[model samples]
Target: MTVRLDHRRVGLDRESLAAAYPSASASGRVVVVVFLHGLVETERSWFHRPRPGKARNGTDFGSRLAEDLAGTPVYVRYNTGRRICDNGRELADLLAELVEGWPVPITEIVLIGHSMGGLVARSAVRQAGDHPTPGLSKVTRLVCLGSPHTGAPLERGVVRVAGILGMFAALAPVARLMALRSDGIKDLARGSLHQDHRAEYGRPVDAGLPAGVRQLFVVATLSRSEGSLWGPLIGDLVVAPSSAGDRTQTADLEWLGGLHHFDLLSHDAVYGVVAEWLRT
Candidate 1:
């Protein structure tokens, strides 16, 4: 019942992954960019891993972002299958631990989350609350790609069926705790991360924004158009442009066209935009 976040194991430790790059000064002002991948995706999805669909591209978004961010301090997180809010809480805890133990004087933290990862990042930021440490005080910027800030309208029967199976599995005590802790119910209730939320839930993290954290929204419009499963609906097949950008008074949202949710991570064009945003 517990959703496994790291499927590939990726051979990287959190300390090493969170570590600033060599060029980054030991003094304050190091920018730690954490890229969170969407549901059913690995950290490899952010850059390059082994993908059955594409032979040339090793994986997807994670590798691509790493490549684009060459020489920059980057950490790619691969945590899929957990509930969105639970993942956010875990992220908050991890950040708290990192900041508490960090040797160097940390300056800035940037969270670039794609699809459901974006929602998770927002939740983490919200949980950081009023007196955020290095996690939020150092957090200068946040970018969300194809995330359904509002709850998405499910495709209907699919998630319901899966929820039933998950319920059966949760009968075991260990799995029951895991299921409850993972935010499985929330995910199921909201359907998949890809569904667009026009009415169901409120903006994913709009209600949970911490005081000083900055926010950005990057949405995908088209995917191949001809043979791709994603149709031209101003969306990444799952989250629409509006849903991705939906926020209350405290957010600064941007609209990026011509990409899918996955492409927002891997595609060079999308990567360039994100890089530019970070630079600004």
Candidate 2:
């Protein structure tokens, strides 16, 4: 993940994928936990020290999740500028290949995605049914952290504001900065999963997740409560709680009182909830 986090290694070839992982136990059953990152972020962002420098906290999602859970932890790194559904389809194939080459027999596949990655994870799971990927049959759980299931209004607003700003002569530079978003971010504007993306790119439909798979949505907020003054206006500084975690699904909800979008990555409360869920 550290290497893949680099801009130079962003387009890693298939040959190098296996090298990213250390060998898992050869005999015992294993579970694969894939951590997909958010928009405009690298795999290293999950660890909280996004830059190339050494980490200060002496703790990270990779190290902590590995210690808390008995499984192989994998960080998925990709070009965030590309179409998310395209990446989703590629990820489905990549994961199947990973299972084929893994040392131990993988008993389960767990997908944890944040923001844009969540849409990719869901789309990948949907697309897998059509192509019949190897490891997909083992998929048992999906955890989406601060995902904008409905849409990412922030990205949408940025797009619109940039378009408006471009008309003005003096604000062209600011417009350029605001308009420097990727197709993946545009996809998040509507929260378009691969299936819906067919309308956008003339792609085919992707549907169905493994039946009875444990699905958990982790929602966070900047304000103390959703009813608070800033809660709906600026949820987690990116996604709304209603979008991150469906309030309707009372049984399947965990509400973190005051956390930003990236806070869920390596926070103790988040890890504890995930650990307990996996244990069950």
* Candidate maximizing lDDT: 2
lDDT (Cα) of model 1: 0.56
- Backbone clashes for every candidate come to 14, 0
lDDT of 1 by residue, 1-280 (tens): 1111244222233454334344433454555667777767656565543324432344444344445553233454644556665676677766665555455555667888777777777767776664354555567678887777664434323444455556665544544443442443366334223223223544343445666677777766764443344443446666655566675436666555555566666665566667677656
**TM-score of candidate 2 on Cα atoms, chains taken together:** 0.80
How many pairs of residues collide in model 2?
A: 0
Question: How large is the C-alpha RMSD of every model relative to the true structure?
Answer: 7.4, 5.2
Candidate 2, residues 1-280: lDDT per residue as tens digits? 2234333452234345445555455456677788889888878778674323323354765566666676667778877777777888878877776677665567888888888887788778877667778867777788888887767768768878998999999999999998887787777876677645524321222335656566788888878775788787788998877677755332267777667888877776677677788788
* True-vs-predicted CA distance for residue 17, candidate 1, Å: 7.0
Query: Per-residue error at 190 for model 1, in Å?
Result: 3.8
Evaluated with TM-score, which candidate comes out highest?
Answer: 2
Global lDDT scores for all candidate models: 0.56, 0.71
